[model samples]
Target: MVISNKALRFIIATFVICLPFISMANPEKDTTIVQTVVAHEGAEASHEAHAEPTDVKSKVKAFIKHHVLDSHEFSFFQDDETGVHYGFSLPIIIYDNGFQIFSSSKFEHGEAVAESNGNFYKINHHDGKIYKTDAAGTITEDEKSGHPTNVRPLDLSITKSVLSILIAAVLMFFIFTGLAKSYAKNNGIASGAGRIFEPVVLFIRDEIAIPNIGEKHYKKYMSYLLTIFFFILFLNIFGLMPFGINVTGNLTITFSLAILTFLITNLTANKNYWGHIFWMPGVPKPMRIVLAPIELLGVVIKPFSLMIRLYANIFAGHIVLMSIIGLMFIFKSWIGSSLSFGLSFALSILEILVAFLQAYIFTLLSALYFGMAVEEHHHEEAHH
Candidate 1:
């Protein structure tokens, strides 16, 4: 039953090694939120912020003056003779009559259009006359463009986050199912795919579950731990790839994971765990009354912390990497560009390790909660 000093020390050392990586990842994400707020404030201070730019910002802009327009969308060669690449990075929805595009690149609203009866109509930005287009991309008479209809395109493309989660889920199903089959075929022992997974599963069973929850109750909690460990681990790794999707970077996904942990913790709690929470045996009656509220609050806060920790770390890392890349575009200088490339490269390597470490921490905490819930209390009198 005793945990050796050496074993305890190793646990401490492992945490020390991984803590900074997780912590750094969070601040980078938080800073972006702060900066966005500040930028919003700055924009509010200027009354003429809506005016068209009288000056060009970069060499590319100076070269392409003619092609660019005051509107967010354009379809011609620039003043500098740079031809428009309609095929590259085209917007999903374009308001051709209104002279605007719903492009992530252009971002700001340049013009507005109206629609009616499954057709789109817009007042031309130049002369303010209405034009119409049908569902099949055909221009129609102005009389037909008077009904309210959806002007958006039916692109139905999956966002990066959704696609990433789907890919991660499929990969986990394949790898773990293969491991399970490998173990089944090898006389209850593992081989092949199982060999890679067996050690980690055994560690969770032998070290985490049995020691914390006791031998009798450990098996009941094993499947949940294994599933969580692998799920988070898979998603984290996928978030680090080049075309990586930040599934855990999403607040909703992280919150759902935390909610599951919360449910399991409460549902699996033995009589003793609840008894201690509501009424401590040795504590004063007056203190127990006050402590009851604190204990109850702890239940909610624990899962909330789990949600924020995972979400913040993943979200922050991605934002930092993207912000550094954004800086390369903003600076337009070799020094800034080269530094951004180097820092992004180094941070990316660190993020890969972090993807594993955060998954382990989340799993470890969840297992600890499960252990607390199912742990059996020994009778002091029987021991004597």
Candidate 2:
């Protein structure tokens, strides 16, 4: 049983050499370490996936589109941590079999279904339209059009645009009413806020209404001209505010304004105006018939142009301005971000001027149309 020192030393060396391999071969410990590493990496990836947008361009485009589109709620901003939106909800009024009225918050930012009078409704995120859906909030889409097949109720909701319009209207009423009272109080001299706005009012009456609509007839249309000018100006200014209200940029709103102009022009047209359009006094009999339809077509084209011009200009301005602002976040560098911020600020200032310019142009064109409709033609005097 006497062991040699050489054999004992050999055994010790062999054990020392194999210790690392034995540890490496242990499956349970290695598996636990591997699982821990994998779980850490997976969690980091998931956090990143949720925290940041994968495609910056797509995010920017979506933000711009959302800026220009009307929504049921006035969302100021969203919290990054909680993912909760900060804004008040407007009322949603829909007429199906009967009126179904509810607060827009019931939709939970288009993530939930709203029930009323035994009917269920859901908001289509794609178009922001409310559609009748089942309790599960299932939406059936048409295969060809890709639009929802669910029946849409008659929407009479006071959307963001509608709310902005109402605000502008109330603001305009108070402003002008105060101005009128000031004029009456101060012996026809406007005081206070009236003093500030009087010059603009006189400019509209003198430069726009009288020149285009004639001094004799301008008085009757001055009230409407002033109302529209300030109404549009206020809405455009509102759009540029941080509140994200794009009332004037809405097509339907512009269309409504154009319709008002159309009605006023044609309804107040003189007999001479209709005569010039249907049967030109100066043209040959055969040629007059040819020109008549074309002239009548011009009537419809005029208002259509007004609607398109206002809508396109305001809508495009908002998109461009917002896109520039979005570039600041994408750049992620001091110099590039500063440049983007500078450009955004300059564009915002220019947008303020555009807001006024658009209002002026709309008012000017509307007055010009009135001038054409009420213009007197002295054919007898011209013949003499």
Cα lDDT tens digits for candidate 1, 8-113? 9999888755532332234665557558656765675443233343322323332222111112222223333553333222242434433343342322221444
Backbone clashes in model 1, listed as residue pairs? 29-316, 66-79, 67-78, 67-79, 115-149, 116-147, 116-148, 116-149
| Tens-digit lDDT string for candidate 2 (1-384) | 987999999998887555433432345865675586567766676454224444455578777877888999999998867989999999999999989999999999888999999899998876889999999989888878878999999999999999998999998888788989988888898877767788999999989999999988988899899999999999999999877888889999999999999999999999999998998887778999899999999999999999999999999999889998997766545555666788899999999999999999999999999999999986662463
Clash pairs detected, candidate 2: none
Error of 2 at 362 (Å): 0.6
What's the distance in Å from true for residue 324, model 2?
0.6
lDDT of each: 0.63, 0.87
Off by over 4 Å in 2: 1-54, 381-384
State each candidate's clash count: 8, 0
